[model samples]
Target: MKTLLYIVLVLISFSVTAQKPVVNSAKLEEIKSYLKHFEDNDALLGSVSVFENDKELLNQSFGAIPASRTTKYQVGSISKMFTAVLIGQLVEEHKMDLNEPLATYFPKMPGASSIKLSNLLNHTSGLQNFVVKQDSLKYWLKKPVSQQAILDEIARQGVAFQPGDSISYSNSGYYLLTRILEQKYKKPYETILEERITRPFGLENTFSLNGKTEYEDTAISYEKKDNKWVKLEEFYFPNVQGVGDIISTLSDLNSFMSALFNNEILKEETLKRMLPKDDDWFGLGIMKAPFYNHIAYGHGGDTYGTHTVTSYHPESKLGITYVINGEGYPTNNFAIGLLSIIYDKDYSLPELTEYTPDKLYYDAYTGTYSSPELPIAITVYQKEGALMAQGEGQSPFTLTPKSKHTFAYLKAGIHITFDPDAETFLFKQGGQQFELKKK
Candidate 1:
């Protein structure tokens, strides 16, 4: 999940070349072959698109989801890019100022006087990630909610720290920004989006969830339960309008990125402010996703079932995007594998393997685990006919078995090797490894 929720998949930072960009038939073939390996293993389902100079190098849909060329998929927080551009436009038109205090738009918000629009833009605002509360089921997350209600929720959660003191991924910041967009234009973010972003960009397939149940060409999302893919109920779109809701196809996303980098949307000067500055990985609405020597400026999004990432090397005019609603293969690793092949880095196609935990094993792993090396305690429990874990302040996520006692929450890149006899498990994430004892 990360820049994809508090649990959303964070787009890894990438770097680019000072040299020329190259795309050959062989590289494209390598990319396709690598994707096919995942497809053949029933490990992935969705579309992948690559474009250089606005020319398609690859536009292919895989998996059994029946995705056609124009099929729509939720792009998640990638919607932030669009929201940011709208804010950027208002700035360009002298209607809004990034340095203005949050008090200008939301005077009563906690730290409103101290928090500037720039704070909200780059996530330096102290606002808590309202989406994180959804993991705790404090609100009816999937129920439609009014704008006032969302603001109330954000206010209720309040600031986690003083403005500009720190940075954390908070959907609350975007939700507030989304409201500011609507308030400034006196229109819904959806309407402003069409008039300013989508329609102008000719991104016909890009749209909000719009309270509709069906889009003829939109692909459905699924979660792997046991070994079967089960349809996942989408979050109420209106409720997540600013944070994690926006739908589009791969081609459309790539096109949007191209336009943004090409200054077809925000002015080059404005776009510059939206990119990662100095040593930070986040910009206003954009971010830095890592490869090796090259950097990709873009965003990644994840909803309940669908997973996606959109990025381009602004210098090379090369963009890469993918949407996966179904996954037996880990989406991020798949992304890295694809990028590796594209950039001629060290890479390996995952050995797509499925694992089924013994039902009896479930009881063995269910416990509260604590570590002296960490502050949070992990509470493992049984849910959805599968093993799941919840940190003290995090959402519960399903744990897929890799072996009898080894499990992974692949979306978050978390691994746990449990030794039930010793009542301890070695936990790993982001390269940090620790042994947690059963408490």
Candidate 2:
């Protein structure tokens, strides 16, 4: 009787152990379902993988590909993490000071005399955005520009703001880091990336060098422009080298995120600087957000045709990577949603409520919203018994108020988060964040 009981107990234990949340056939199907839904919504095209601690829990590809396991996808701004790691290496070697002025490195970026290295990494150097101000779609479609051209353009425009005053996303900042690294190592950015970062870390699927892309098994990038799917055309190799360009697999991204969170790639002190808190959304090069009781740090990348996001939790060592070949997909929100499920929590994504504001109080929100940088003033008023918004040239947009002050644009897919202290609201749309004050 005792022998029989022991056998049954062992079988039950094995079953329970086998059911832990790792990549299994069932989970693979679930991931596939997600990809199918993503394609159905015209959300994006891409691949994905999930990891718990160091073990790869899930790897799957969707949309126009076979053998995608070895495929190289344009990781877009996911390259920023590589830049950050390289910068960390320089700091570790005592070759560059993060706090020193940017002029120390390039010495040619017009106001580099005053811009600090830390500001460059933190996006607070008041630098004008290169791609946004230019004919980006046409330019990216043609070919990549030389690194010298990037620097020259910045020098021509000069600095847009005083250092360390505000946060603005700038690809130019990372481009400048590429120049600095080349100057310091006496080697190309690709060489440094391989020797110091990818190769050393055993990230076999990631590559910094650009050549003919092997797309046999790669996910095809697509964009839903004007309500139709548009295939993304690849551009000539970019010269920004270390900054915003790289090709990687989901496996490599998961490995990189693990190394970063585990402190295998950076000292504890350096990693602390990389965590969110320096700003609401961005750290040195990673994006930080509150996840359950622990802090999540990672980065999201979106170039012309591709969008990617990878995140890892420090306490749980849980991580996820969502790589989409198409631009403008909601990878960040999807990543957040997956995190919520893994942790068995819920996320407060923007939603529309049935409750409409009372006619008496509707006047309170009717006014012009003024911001310094935005090109137009937002006019908020009640229409057809519902509050709506419209700018100078934009069509009328509806508002879904989550609370008394918090509102979301249901049609445009943005959030209006009000700040009590500033007596204003912040509008976030497609990773572009800005503020508005009542006029």
Scored against the true structure, residue 298 in model 2 reaches a CA lDDT of: 78
**How well is each residue in 226-305 modelled by candidate 1, as lDDT tens digits?**
65678988777777786678888899999999999999898989999889987788899888875666777888887777
Candidate whose lDDT is highest: 1
Give the clashing residue pairs of candidate 2, or none. none
Q: Model 2: runs farther than 4 Å from truth? A: 1-32, 39-43, 64-67, 134-141, 211-218, 224-230, 234-237, 291-294, 327-333, 346-439
Q: Which candidate is the best by TM-score?
A: 1
Model 2 RMSD in angstroms: 12.7
At residue 391, give the lDDT of candidate 1: 96
lDDT per residue as tens, model 2, 384-422: 766777887877766655676667653346777665456
